[model samples]
Target: MTNRVEYLRSPTAIRERCNELFELAQADQLPYFRVDLTQLDAVADYVIAVIREHYPDLDVPFHSRWRHFEVGNIPRVRQLEQAIESRSKIEQAKAKFDLVIPSVLLDAGAGDCWKYHEATTQKTWARSEGLAIASFDAFCQGAFSKHPYQADATALKQITPEQIGAFFQVGSENPLVGLEGRSALLQKLGQTIEQSPDLFGDVPRPGNLVNYLIGHADQGQLSAVVVLNAVLIGLGEIWSGRLSIEGVNLGDVWKHSSLSGDQLIPFHKLSQWLTYSLLEPLQDLGLKIIDLDQMTGLPEYRNGGLCLDLGLLQLKDPKLAEIPHAADSELIVEWRALTVCLLDRIAATIRKKLGLTPESLPLVKVLQGGTWTAGRKIAAALRPGGTPPIQISSDGTVF
Candidate 1:
């Protein structure tokens, strides 16, 4: 039982399980969506066009939460770097982890209405950008720690929904979805860090993960999967009301009826996102990050939405789009599983078009220059406020 649970938490499991559903989708055995390979070429072309528009020279960064910090071309991460420039290299890495870990956890759907007004820049930002800026501002003000730049467990365990709401400037008119869930996640994160002394260290800080990963590095080189494993093991318990096996909480893994036995499918979307976000800091510390493609594409709305908007995936029941679906529902789970498979296909097609290999143009880069932005563009053109084709009821956790 424990071994099966461990397998479910692995990247191989994510690919294999999602591929199983994709095969079912291809055979027209799935209940909700149809696979449209004919439209894949058009989808690939659209994503390539978006890539060209964003990066004409074809250089693209990894798709991570860090990109949100650069919203409005504001150089927010640069500002943080400058502030912590005097710290030692290890401390700097820790600070980066401190900021991005919570930021990514807070980065579920912000709904269509919520917006953040940056007092420094006098700019109004919405959605992910807004959430990033809000969390950034809160961190800058020491919302997560006594010091203005660290996230210590003592502070995080005591965080409240009202405090998060205040930090985000949430009010009746400017409501953010899943306020309590977001707060609870952070509180749990604090507890997880405090309890996992081997990973977080005795100091009980999120930044201590830097030390843990550094220790795990083999000759200053690490696989992306190692980082992902640390993330899942260190922070898995932060997830609320998730499936568990032998007392192991399966964060972001879900269920689908098409599969036999447990019918479980894993899509550790946010954990993988956190892993991607952590890579830059590891790289900055001069650690070589290898096996980059081992980590699968994030199975989120943007990437999944790209598939739906471009007709790569068509819903058998078109009415499914009009109603809000729970994140754990079979329809949503299957949609996300199909998304994981399609992103690989899209990445391959994009690489072929650009005459590049997976090494030069990895799935993460494809997501950045490629699919996610294309999805948003298509969504904006197809609907009001650039909403996803399928509406999901968010709980400030899973998308």
Candidate 2:
């Protein structure tokens, strides 16, 4: 049996740990991605560059299409669509995610506000939007949606305190703000917008607010994880079909596979576990999470069920460019795919060290035990929304 300290010592050992996770994912046929800790700083630097060039603000407003009862005539959506169309699958995915991440954050603020945009039906379906505000105060007793900014009790010309209170209420009969909280929140949301003129112009529009929200940055690792993960979940659900997460059944799938143990250790569990690890941080921040697993898991295959599984990724030709961006080449996609496989390898080893069986250690539990938690914590420090979860920072990209 390997001692815990020994496993925690060397990078080579950690790499081996990653290899194990990949093997496990291969066994379960799960879509896993490897996150390079060595390159994490580099990737973070890239992220920081983009964010600084774009967001550069500590406070950001959360907005989305859900707030817009009607779609305004703006090329913002088209700009995003065009940017993504010219990029690779991974980059395209990221772009699409960036396009609407603010919407996701606002949705989170509205207590998981989601509405099915039916292109087929030409009609959208939405849960009552103000539910978050109403319910939050009730849940935490004026903490979640606390009525802190009291302007007035009743006034016709000026915005009333009663009027401001209604927007976020979960439910209100003789509500204070009534349906006006949306506008008030939208007005308060302008603070984030005005901060970034390039990202979000000074206009009563949706897309710019959306862009500004995306560019906004949350605090540290844990917060980043929460915000990013939630955004990923939201985007996946909106863009892709309903996110079909492979839950406990993944263990059954992993047990029947033939991947080597070396490749399976550390990576498998880590890949799966990293998904929802931000929950603790969100709860710690006094945010009430109505549903822990609202978003489903990803489907980007690494080893188990993709061409890359047959050692195709290892066969790819390597090319170097002075400035590497996802829009540049297949390098990003191939690297991302390789990452998925590698992540699985890491999970398997960690599971063994923890003396956890595959059945006892489902995919969700892995997410709960991983770096996503740390990501959420980091994000909390970056900005309020306690984990950034979906709020866009001027960082300007879907990280």
Clashes of 2: 90
TM-score of 2: 0.25
Ten-residue stretch with the least lDDT total in model 1: 254-263
Which stretches of candidate 2 lie above 4 Å from their native place? 1-322, 327-329, 359-395
* C-alpha RMSD by candidate, in order: 0.8, 20.9
lDDT of 2 by residue, 1-399 (tens): 234322322223334443454444444433323232343333323323332333344121112232232233324334444634655443333333222222222332222233333332354434322332232222222221122211111111233334334423324433221234333333333333344455434432223322333344343213323443322322222211111223211110111122344222222122222223323323333434332222222222211112222222332222332233331123333333345443343344444554655445433333323322333344445445432222221111112
lDDT of candidate 2 at residue 134, scale 0 to 100: 31
CA lDDT of every candidate: 0.93, 0.30
Quantify how close model 1 is to the true structure by its C-alpha RMSD in Å. Answer: 0.8
Evaluated at residue 213, the lDDT of candidate 2 is: 31
Candidate 1 residues lying further than 4 Å off, grouped into runs, are none
Query: Which prediction has the highest TM-score against the true structure?
Result: 1
